[model samples]
Target: MIGNGCWFEFDEVRGKIIIDGPMTTDLSFAAEEMQKYVRRAHGMFLPIQRGVLSESTQNAIVVRIMAERLATVEEDGFAITYRNGNVFIEGNGIRSVLYGTYRFLELYAGMRWLTPDHEVIYEPTDRKVWIEERHDRPDFRRRGIILEGVQSASYAIGVIDWMSKNGCDLLMMTIEFWDEHQAALRPEMQARQLRLGLGGHSLDRFLSPGDYFEVHPEWFAWYEGGRVAAQPCFSNQEGIAFLIGRIVDYCRQEPDMDTLSLFPNDNKYFCQCPSCSTQSFVSNYTTFLETVRDQLEADGQSVRIQMLAYNAQIEWTMLESMPEAASLDVMVACWGRDYRQTIGSPAGDRDERFRRIVADWGQACSQRYHSSLSVYEYYADYWMMTSLFPPLARTICKDIEEYRSMGVQEMICLLLPYEKSVRIMQEEIMGLPRENNLADREFNSETPVMWLNLYMFARKLWNSSLDEAGLIDEYCRAAFGQHGDTGKTLLYALEQQLAQLTVYNTRWFKLRYTDVWIRDHRSKGKAVVTGVSPWAKEEDEPEIPAERSEVSRRIVEELEDVWHKAAHQGAHSDESTLLYQALTQYFRYVIQKLRSIDKQSSAQSKLIRQETEEAMSDLTEALQIETEIRGWDALHFAHRLRDPNVL
Candidate 1:
């Protein structure tokens, strides 16, 4: 450690904090964070005070803003230099100032905020520390995360603070207009522009039946027999005018909004009246969109507007030429691509089809109207993390690169909150290992990599060009602390192993119905096995796949090794230990189930029953352990495991 680089004199005791001038909310937040961590580490709470330091001030830590570095550090860039028992944090903007403080906390004060509710500040017993100079800013203009699963107020604040500190500059959370939590979060989201967008699935706000449909039946869509109040008929000139009027009114109320997303409802059916039927759904949508844009421009308003090319809008056949307007960016709503493959790879063929469609629209938008494109991606699956382990982060990283290559910079993600519940079904119990009685235990567990995936998502969005291994290293180091490298290695291996499961439908994947699997990977061999069947009697069950069983056993063994090695790395708590144990046990259950299937022919009825009981037992124990570690409101929506049920 460099002695002169220390910000405060080390006496294994308290320190004084001195401020250089007036404080803004961001700066005040920085001071408070500094105060919280320093005391946490040294048992010495520093009091933040105003004005110049007096001679009586001892071991004083100064928080000062230096304007000289503004030109060098552009936008929200920041720099930190420490010398003569004082730390100086300088920034070009409020975000930079707060970021510098967080960098200081992480590098010098041993602070780590990995997840919303999980924070680690390893206070050194010796209380002797020194941090070298540092500076950084994000690469993307709109580095943000979709706050889909952040359930509570405290959790929301944690996500905001974590993002800001990590150099993220944007957030997409559709908080209700009158939500109480908005007051707490809005202030922190100042430097990072918070965007609220209405989804395409619902247009009640823009074309509400409560106000219009009761009087004008022509305003809504024509259903099987008659008109429905849900979706609007765009052909009616008066209805279109009314819709535009409502939007204008909305803009008047939300004058400070950065962007207004004018999305159609999620349903596939659009207007099919004689006037609307002449053009495709997109033509009708865009005609109104351009009119809205023109109206907004006519009114001299400067709001960036976007809408989704969603549902049937994605199908080239269902729509004509892309929306004719150049001023609006299309937020392409898409899913069903294979996550196991990268965009240019063979596994990505299904993925490439969507890419072509998106690229075509992007080019058209850019060339015709100079408007770029963005995405509303399903980064992960919700609730299914309980069984499936998809390569969520890897796929997200791949998509971001692909999107950037197409000259698309802005990406909005959809989040589905994870719910905790123990599944119960007598027939489903057969899905467990033979001789296992694990289902007797009451517990629910989710994906172990959920937090890691979220962390990588934020970090990569900030710097997509960062080396993959290096990024994983940084995340693991912060998340698992001393055991960080071990965690990183495990995560890297996990991604590879998990990808293998995406295209195969194991009996295990059948526990839940999923259409996520890409292709069948099972070898072309069929032989009867007794213990594993669709509850069939011993005569006709296909032999369990030996290769798959070997793979499962190998994964479990490797995880056990990681679990043990990670013990020495020192986790923030026993949470990591539980995670490892639970993961290891889950694969073991898979292996055990396959074994019983392999031995099905010779096993007695009682023995088969015992085997089924055993697999359930392993599953039960793992979930019981995992329940203690994972949280309820996860924003990494739809982190689904590979499902082989669908073609």
Candidate 2:
């Protein structure tokens, strides 16, 4: 029986899902997903039927590719409406249909995919569904995360599933690893309709030095005084032709590859030959891109070519000089930009340079037929921060708004897995001391803080107008239930503490190692090791300011209090409990790390070593908790603590 003013009644006995269009894989998957979620939420299996429905199918959930109706909708946009005793889900394309189904489940069923391993579903108390018409689309054309470091095939598949559930449409893997795991990864990606992108500093792979250095040395870059096998000689016609041929053959082998990146070797090494030196690296790179685009077109291949605006290629003048090509995608990499602040708010010269580079690229990409501007971000780059959690949700949201305003259509971030830690733990079981293992563990586990940043990044890329605070609260609620407010407080407190600690570290380092020393070493093209004071005598080194040490202590105490309160409230589910344990252990590790830093400045050598040992023990506990929860080891700041004397 239909109630008054009810658009559709979700009757367990009579209601059904009606597919009103040709069934594609994505469409079929969407129907199955809808059915599965409905069953989970209401203990009702809504029978799925493909074809025109009879009049008796009154209270039905209708899904179709209403391309004609969605004339103005983006290719991945969707519309959902409830009218005439039925719920209608419509999209302009197959991917949009799947997105519509997920969105419907989110809005009406209260479902959330918080992390790769965490899902929350809330059942509707009312059987009658009532909703106004709604249409939704992503603000960015390509929203995705790049898999970096080492990971298992199953882990990669889990990330893909999470991306699909969150409406992320792109999945980029480095070419070297993708070749090894594509067999197990491609099917999962195909079923979800996620775009596959392959490449990352992969020019070396296509034209390795070992293969050509002996036969044709001209193929390598001419650096300093002679040729070096760092990168391909972009100006060499023969080398360019060989590189193009290899790329075309690769595309031919993998016809399903949506994008191929020809990013140069991951360094500032560029050809210094007469031909290359006549112009900037960016200009040479642009020529290489144009040349590759021509080759791909001539070969009748449809793979989009990508290049990085990184290192020596980030010059604004060079970017401005290049002519626009519709076939080229430029991914601007933010390697050294400060993550503590938004890109729109430049706090230093480096930040301003990155901002200008992105703006210049945006202007350059605007003339292209396709949205070609992309950003290679590092929100979850564990290696860069030595495995510390980067609390940058608000910064990421504001930065995305800036990018969107600049006509940037795509964004991908580096997200590493915790497999290295798992491998180390297995070795530890064989007889290695945990402290001995800490010295080599560079990549660590993804903490809750990292997951939160990734979650907010994905959400903001889709909807730029979403409030960061609201999203944080939403994630906390989904992850912690009744203790969500406490969880939110703890997260904000941790972020504030980390931000303050960054400031403290900057001040401490500057005081100990004069800025003049850093600038002089940089000018001499020498790598200045951080935390190593240039003073010849140990007594000349500055002491840690008493105020900074006190602030550090206060931060540790505050975090410990909040962590205890949150833990006391407990989690709402089994997964939430595991997350809570990880968070608690990680919090302890952070506190100990701060203590070690504080002690290093003033305490005796023995005291400093003791603090270091305590920090390592706490980190090991956190890693153990992570392995139990995720079936893999997560890395942390153990490497950083290995030499406490340096701090």
Candidate 3:
């Protein structure tokens, strides 16, 4: 024991994990975790006891859910302090109790929960543990993840467990599959006090055309001089009433649901009838939400309604006449912003518009509306930029700070799975065949770049002022052990190359096409137009420039040099070895892909075909290696590589 009170020591065989609060499931879970970790680290099982400890008990670890402490701490906040002869882990709520327990294990035992299935436990060399008094809370009130492309219950549960360990407070999924997952997911979510949110692009579910269009054709949207099932006719009072009734029923059925989205379909189709045409789509949407809110309130339901400021609803001018509801949440989806730059720094016209939209919503929510605001960011948008990992750690950190300054209460990002293999279900859901499914590919190795970005995003959400470099260094040392410095050097070099490549692949290509289109139209003495049809002639597309191939070649060489240096100079532990092997294989695939692209710009058709075949072969080999390592087929989405037409 140190100082006046006995601090809980790792090697304390007599220490008892005391549950001072009511024996709830979460508290019991926390105690069990503490007991389990202590046993794993010290080869000694600490007995867990209920109620108050005897006077003779010494060096005990007490866990409690102190509801009275809510006055001092947030509901998810926790405190660890030494009192008398015991160490107390007290929290404002049951979930916080689990959080406090994890923090305790992390700080004193040097335990790191790096991933869902992977963790690093550092045993003390001297068999002694140091203790400190700490109080902690998240900077963002709601740090969450919106589940996409994930199907398995086991994988979903794994994600929830990892979220609980990392202090994530909310998990959202689309309403279409809530019934499929809720039975398996609800218990786990409830134990962790994680807020369950359902609904996305699901206005159709509430007022689907299939169920009502035949009988009520007038209820559907009027488009191109005919009624379409794309959206409900917002001008029609009966249609709005039917939609609200369905929403109310859903809220009543899923009482555990914290928030429900009333977003339009994943398209720009809106009612073009004279009544709806009189106002913007956003104004009509606001009126519809207000009606729904009124009905929900009348029904005495307290579930929050989520609305999207996306696509057609992105313009701030559309929101001029909108009213606010305290229970309404405005999720500004930053869809088209350049991930290379922070939101405050506009990369182009689209980015500038998105920034303005975000700012307008923020100001409206703070000054006029008093409604909760959140950002739906796309850091891991695999669908848009397949198999490309942008270096967005600094951008992520800065973005969170900007959002927090703008009075945003929550930040939710779309994250891809880190699992090595997952089973692919039906084609309709995944959009890839089971036999040749690119969406179900295995990673064969750990994706450190993506993992680091995710870790940075989560940490920044909790503490905006966190030092990015320091955090990187900490993760590197923990992950790579003694050769962490070399690992850091390699990672920095990799990011630099990736930053250049990402710009070239995304921004430059976009600008190049626009420039080509403008030049072509000017040469023909025709007006340059927007929203060019997809049916435009293939010959109109510009060929890949020689300069792009040269740039890719230079990047490939740099990455190869970095990989070579790290492999030879950097010492390796089992973890580092795995990391390096996975990175090496991924780098090999990247190099081959670049070579294939370089060959595509060649004048010879024979060379292009040969390179394409070789690249495919390389990918197949990499996947085989991954399968050999994991002994299973890992489900990963990499449609770009799998599609021969893309190559």
Sort every candidate by TM-score, greatest first: 3, 2, 1
Instruction: Give the C-alpha lDDT of model 2.
Output: 0.68
Q: Give the alpha carbon lDDT tens digit for every residue of 170-231 in model 1.
A: 56655343144667766656644334443243467767789888899898887666788857
Q: Give the alpha carbon lDDT tens digit for every residue of 367-443 in model 3.
A: 77778888987676443333435546677777888888877888888765433123322243234445534443423
User: Considering lDDT, which of the candidate structures 1 and 2 is the better prediction for this target?
Assistant: 2
Poorly placed runs, candidate 3 (over 4 Å): 1-6, 24-26, 122-127, 312-327, 417-432, 436-446, 499-540, 543-551, 571-577, 601-647
Cα lDDT tens digits, model 2, 243-279, are 8889889888998788887777766667999999987
Per TM-score, the best of the predicted structures is: 3
- How many clashes show up per model? 27, 4, 5
Better candidate by lDDT, 1 or 3: 3
Better of 1 and 2 by TM-score: 2
Cα deviation of 93 in candidate 1 (Å)? 4.2
User: Could you say which candidate leads in lDDT?
Assistant: 2
